[model samples]
Target chain A: MPRFSSNHLETLLTAVDTGSFEAAARALSITPSAVSQRIRAMEALAGQVLLQRAAPIRPTTAGETVLRLARQVRLLDEEASRALDGSGAAVPSLPIAANADSLATWFLDALVEVRREADVVFDLHREDQARTAALLRDGTVLAAVTAERRPVQGCVAVPLGIDRYRAVASPAFVDRHLPGATSGRDVLARLDAVPLVDFDRDDDLQQGFLRRVVGHAPRSPRHFVPSSADFARAVELGLGWGLLPESQALEPLAAGRLVELAPGRVADVVLWWQHWNLRSTLLDAVTAAVRRVAAEHLRPSPV
Target chain B: MPRFSSNHLETLLTAVDTGSFEAAARALSITPSAVSQRIRAMEALAGQVLLQRAAPIRPTTAGETVLRLARQVRLLDEEASRALDGSGAAVPSLPIAANADSLATWFLDALVEVRREADVVFDLHREDQARTAALLRDGTVLAAVTAERRPVQGCVAVPLGIDRYRAVASPAFVDRHLPGATSGRDVLARLDAVPLVDFDRDDDLQQGFLRRVVGHAPRSPRHFVPSSADFARAVELGLGWGLLPESQALEPLAAGRLVELAPGRVADVVLWWQHWNLRSTLLDAVTAAVRRVAAEHLRPSPV
Candidate 1:
């Protein structure tokens, strides 16, 4: 007999998917005791603690390896069911991680196209671009739009494009805070003293951009707007200056709502499509849509 | 000597605020060893570990108690500096937690108004409506906009008003999925069969609405659009039917882009303003602005 059962792997997936043993049992149409038993059986067979039984259950490092195996099994199982029935009855849930800016601007457009003909659901895990690939490694997501160039152990990285961000502020904000500062040199000198907007405390883009302009990330009054749209809106509303993606900034810049602080200096973040190494039809469709739509919106990220 | 020193408390806040001992040293113009020694000294004085020595350091439960004390001391010290200098050079950074929707709609308006007068910066922590108060409990944020009506251990809750949500979908979506299903009964009967949008798996608004309309949360293909504005936009693009806050739904509904699925059935989420019960002038100003602006946009939550 094999050490792992397909049923137990699925139970582990369901438990993590629904976030609790009870919810997983309800989802799988099994008793909570059965869910616990399957998990325990898998742990006993593996000889390691595979899960952290907390408020919302989390898979341990050892469990992550099992989870990757389980996801591949589930994908194959769903593909087989579709092949057998051709009814589009079993919907595949694709878990993908993405940065907030991409999600707001162009990522959903790909999913929209996928949902047009495909019978599928999506679980989008929002993380910073730098950390999105960790989700892929942890088996939390099958794919990710990340800044990571190298692939995870069981994943392949495909270059999406460069997402360029420029330092911009509302017309009124420039008038008030950065008065008489127009050119790159003028702006860089005054940039540290003026207020700015950040996505959150950990959002180092603004600070990073400032440091590139000046020597150090000097003290500045910052407003933390956590939402992508609202972060742009806060800058548009003259709250402070911020670095916005070209996708979000172009139209507003054309409309005379925003002005560039420095003309030539722009931060370019190269994003990549990292997905599990799989031969499933669902993964192919998602990757195709993501690549096609991303090409339309993003600049060339040539090596 | 008092058990705690203001310098030690500030060090703790700086360490947590900068998210690293190395970064805190850079910010405070101190050596990394000195930073470690300060944290160790605080831990020895308090008889417990104050900060987790890891990436993006977090405070333990005992550390939270010290964090709150540190924050209070910092607030008082800043207030004193401003009072003495009368120059507004010592700008205070107020950390506040809020739901995504409120941040997207009326919450930022209050911040904009506050910025027009005060010279303070803001750090906004985004959490779900159910979990925001946890930030206050853990001393991560000084204030919060929460659905939690009961005050945390050392906080006060004031009614912020109600955010009303209604089931809505783009007209094209309804035309495609719920064809000729005009009445509430018609839509509710087939709602479970149609694809839906959720903020995330943790978002139970749509499921709760479905359970009220039907018997159970019947399986439906779901799209997780996590951003506050993007979630509304996804529904507008006809990806899936979703519950939209009236503030977001009103214009689209008026413009005939979106149609109400269940006209009279609405989800009313009451919001409350919770802040640390402190005598500082900054908290008073923030609470006043939050109350004043929230009054303009939200419905009466009289109780």
Candidate 2:
């Protein structure tokens, strides 16, 4: 087995992180030729090509194995440095993935609390709930808030709690787009014809709920507002009716600015916190903070 | 010369848009075999492969030529349909790319105004200011709000306005991380050592300004908060000092919730509106609305 030496692994990480050899060299304070040489030496030992050499570099299958090993080594190294220094400022930033809605609503509070006690830094990648685990697989992030219940290969999963959503529209939007309906079933049938707002193309929360409501996703026109805050605001501006998370939907509902389109109906996304199965004290601190804050904000997970 | 037929072109567009032959078939109400056959026939006529057999479909160089043609045809067809039917609802959604800050602040107002006049819909893509133009090149978005002053090929660029940003920190953040400075130079001198908050790794506004201030990007610890509204909120919550656009920073600055880190110094991003050079009335409406709203919010571009 060809072991990846730490110096060569550092070069590999910088190359992929920056996307090109020349750029990586600038970041690592080395020449592009040196970066190319280091990568070539590693490839020769491994007997396989590591990078695709594309504009934004991508790792080959063999490279992924080495990348994971490199990341593990890096984490252990950082943990060791923190232990030695004791000042805690030498800790490297921990990369994590989170869904946009959670990041917008409550995840930062956990990070802020963590920062208050530890001199730590973070690199957050905003990803879809369905896709965040891929970051963990690629060794791009150490932790994720994801919808996937099955733990990624070497990670442990914990239930964060349910993020409940309800179909809502501005009072003016309800007056304009949806027909008045008295019964719950009547509203369900009418949902197939009205305009809706989606967080993005992959945002099937509205569509999935409509499918459960009317047996198929609607052919209705949609306005894709890719940001979580903007998606709620789009509904408030009467662009279209949308599913707003309970945290965002509640206040406006009470204020009478937004009205529920479907009474007694809500969409619940059961979010999970998944992190590397590692034993660093700093990682444990983050995990604890995330659990504490999530408990405070979210409803209990269903059995 | 192989000219693409309208039906075959529609198949191409659907396949690329949906990202797989099976998904395209589902979307177009056809069988996957039929979708594959149509693309094969088109490829045979062109004497070249059009699509990359990736999990999510990708276009080859020759396919980009065809993709551009298909988009132009689709826009024209929708325009003709609206004219002949005399009903504005036949129009399809327009995909547009914008940076998070603009989308969170001023962009949606333009979209709401555009929605009021036409029954047209939108598909928004949230991208970094530096990369929005690439969305226009790939046919993923018909238009973009980008920092690129030069127009993409086949697109026209118009000045939106200059978005000015200032480095700000919550009062508590300053009290902890920064030295009380007597002069502008002293503040600049101390800024290199403090913790900072970034929108993401590629957010260079803070780094770029720091480089100009003291001649290089800082090695300070950073917290990456990806959302625009939340990035500003993270700064206000005393996470770290960050650059905030004038629109988001002013009220908090006046209210003493946030304090300016670098007084009288601001980073200005000159924004441009770029769209396909097509004469569609709907595209014209979006272009006009964007210009009108941007003028209302942003500072004038430098001469």
Candidate 3:
């Protein structure tokens, strides 16, 4: 096996990251010809084609293996640099993917607490919890807050806790649309009449809630608000009823701005923190901060 | 040819929109059985299966054809209701998709201006300009601000204007990394040492600019800040050089906080206002408002 040069690996990583040989060259501050040469040399040594050379270039299956290796090496180098320097100012930028709801609520607090202790810069990618793990697979992010239970390859999954949501609506909405609802059947019947708020086209929480409680999905006209903060506000504004995180609903419920429609029934979403198994101080600090904040804010996971 | 019942079409549309027969029933304020009957009747009449019976239901190829018809009828109904009502207070919700950069910049001004005169509630979907048109095609949004010059079917495309961006960096960063840059070549050569800021992994504006001017892509350490407002702030904080909208970069440039890397070269992205071609007064009003705002804020489209 030919020994891989870190410089060639660096060039290959940049080319993949930037999506083109030219873009990678610009990012590496090298000539485009130099970037191509380095990549070619690596491909020759590996005895396989690495990149597809498409617009915003893509890695072939062989390239993905090489890319993963490159990322591991880069992480170790950064770890070594931090160990040698012991300076807070030169903290590495830690890129992590998280769902919008977490970002809108408790995630920022965790980030703030982490920042207070460490000099790391955060690069956050907001995505759905169900999909965030893909960022890890693609090497776009080093860590993620995801709903996936299984760990991505080369990563460890830790249960952060459950974010419980409740079916909530404005007081006036319940009164106007759901009058004389004395029984579960009546409430289920009245659900058809009330407009529902959805997080977006892909949001299924409300439907899932309806399915579990009423034994059927209620098809109500929906107002889709894509933003996490705005979606809660829409429900509060009486645009529609929706599943609001308990952390978000509690204040409005207490303030009389919102009321729970189905009081005991909650939509519990279990979240996990998935990070590279590599031992890096920044990753460790972030994981610790997330766990600490989640313990205080999120409900304990169901046994 | 058999005539389609607007009622049956409505049921079909709701089923697809809500992703289930039960959810559609709730929106229409009818029983789930009634929804099923209407859908079955439509399918029998058309001799085709309209929906794939799955969780969070998906429309079949034939169902998509029917779904489009249902949307057209709904839009016409809304237009008719507004025409007959002539009441500003009961204006319908207008959901539109736009790129994040525009949302962080001048898009809000247009929204505010439109809101001042109309009682319409805005449901904004933040997406990339390259992808916003997908929302229109799938009937998730009625309108979009997109980079695509072509009009979506049943939609009219209007030239909004050009949003020009400039390559910029913090003064301190330039001083530290790019000292004694007499020519574009020197700046290009120094780019490898300087960090770069990216909006996301998909953002290629910086790389595109470098390829055009410097003739190669540089592979430098990058900090990806996905939010437009935050991305600009990252550049201002001396994190990295990036392409910033002229509207955002001008103030910083004047204040000596940021400096232009390439003095004359600029990336001009032409934006379009695409909306459904319907006889809706509200859509017309919004189109007029967006065009008015674009005229004032953006450069006239290239002749």
- Prediction 3: B-chain TM-score: 0.85
Best-matching candidate per DockQ: 2
Local distance difference test values of all predictions, in order: 0.88, 0.86, 0.77
**Between candidates 2 and 3, which one is better according to TM-score?**
2
Candidate 1 lDDT? 0.88
Q: By descending lDDT, how would the candidates be arranged? A: 1, 2, 3
Candidate 3 lDDT over A1-303, as tens digits, reads 467898898888889777789888876789999999998998999999988988878888777778777776776676677778875324467779888778667776676566556545667897886667777886767888888879999899999999999888888767766878776556766774466777766667787877776667554655566767667766776767889988889999999999778777788899899998887877898899999998898999763
lDDT of 3 at B264: 83
Across all candidates, what is each one's fraction of true contacts kept? Answer: 0.65, 0.78, 0.28
Where in model 2 is the C-alpha error above 4 Å? A1-3, A45-47, A86-91, B1-3, B45-47, B86-91
Q: Each candidate's DockQ score against the native complex?
A: 0.67, 0.73, 0.20
Q: Write candidate 1's Cα lDDT for B1-303 as tens digits.
A: 237888888999999888999999988999999999999999998889989998898999889899988887787787779878875556777889999899889998898888788677788888896678778988888899988899999999999999999899998889888998968899989998888889987778888988888788667778787889999988998888999999999999999999999889999999999999999888898899999999999999966
Q: What would the per-residue lDDT of candidate 2 be over residues A164-280, giving only the tens digit for each residue?
A: 998888988767665566666766687767778888767778888988888875777778898888888999999988899888999999999998888789888999999988877
Q: What lDDT tens digits, residue by residue, belong to model 1 across residues A1-303?
A: 236999999999989988899999999899999999999999999998899999799999999899988988887887788778875557667889999899889999998888787777787888896677678887888999988899999899999999999999998888878788757789889898888898976578888888878887668877788889999998898888999999999999999999988988999999999999999888999999999999999998786
Sort candidate 2 into its docking category: medium
